[model samples]
Target: MGLLVFGGACLQGVGGLGFSMFCAPIALLLFPELVPGPLLALGCPLALLAGLREFKAIEWGTAGYTLVGRALGAALATAVLQVLSGPTLSVVFALLILGGVALSVQGWVVRVTPAASSAAGVASGLMGTITSAGAPPLAIALQDLQPAPLRATLGCVFFIGSVMSLLALAAAGKTDAHNLLIGVLLLPWMAAGFFASGPLARRMSRTGVRRVLLTLATFSALAVLAQGLLHSQA
Candidate 1:
């Protein structure tokens, strides 16, 4: 688990949003208790570190809009979860993410307007709360930004979203002392990976970042899809 956290943190440090993407699927299969709640808790500090690393580059206006949307989406997800199965929601959102990635590849550039950001945030919140894989929507929406701003803005948005998610999980009785302790114990690994990513982040070009971002987004969607399918089968 420490190794997993370390690796995921390094990926997030370089691309601003991949810790859960990289960790959730494996953890779900092995350390099931470590996911959603504990992973979301760990994400908060990791995102904070990334945001502070490029504080000046954060888009405050976009972040604000995204947060509001995230709150609404989370609320909606909470209500929806009572009605729908998690695997069903996961499959739906995973398809949506893949569609977004496809459009992006086809030259559909999403401008960082208030509506787009907020909408992406809503999707992010819903998917994140259910699947612990929320970054894909927002990452796709902001993929056009320069690397620094992209990383910083995503970091900020994710930080707040993560906190909101933790609260939601706590209210839903998904969080507990054991999971919180797991998150706390993994902090050192997260920190180590974050610091280690500095040199690699500095060396990555804009194109490289975009490629990595898109790839990660696609991987996130696929992983969610697989998870949903497996759960449905079971």
Candidate 2:
């Protein structure tokens, strides 16, 4: 597991999405029992820290508008999933991600107007709750903003939302020692990636970034598909 996390760090060093896009799938392979629930819960702290680190860069009007609907959507997903069987939920979210990928390919960009942002917040919350895979829409929406605010706002929102998610998971009694260790172990990786972000972001071309993101997303999705096909713990 530690070795897998080290791999995660290298991927993260390349781009910001590796924690979820790379680490999560590999972790899923090694620890299916932990994936959609407990392990996902532990990682919320890293997500929270990510956002909080860029708190100053958040646009109040935008974040405030977005969070309202996001909270609502998160609440909705939580309420729904509390009763659903695990397999059912997995299939549902897999379909949704397939849809998102399709949307991405179809030139259907998510606009970031006040109304759209709020709507996307709800989508983010729901999608995040469903799969812990919520960023494509928000990323596309914020792509046009200045890079600093764009990244900072994302970090802040992910952090804040993830804190709420962790609290929810804890209340549900899903945590365990292994996941705790996983989150702690990821600390150094997250720090290194965050520190290196300055130069890496500067050096990365947008086209290159998008290509990397797409490739990693495909790999992650394929990992999930493989798990489903092989009747692994999905």
Best by lDDT: 1
lDDT (10s digit) by residue, model 1, range 102-176:
888888878889999999889877887788787888878888888888889989988887887788789999899
Identify the runs in model 1 with alpha carbons over 4 angstroms from their true place.
79-84
Give residue 149's lDDT in candidate 1 (0 to 100).
89
Provide TM-scores for the models. Answer: 0.92, 0.71
lDDT values of the candidates?
Answer: 0.89, 0.59
Estimate the lDDT of model 1: 0.89
True-vs-predicted CA distance for residue 20, candidate 1, Å: 0.7
Minimum summed lDDT over a 10-residue window in model 1 is located at 160-169
Give all candidate RMSDs, comma-separated: 1.8, 4.1
* Candidate 1 C-alpha RMSD relative to the actual structure: 1.8
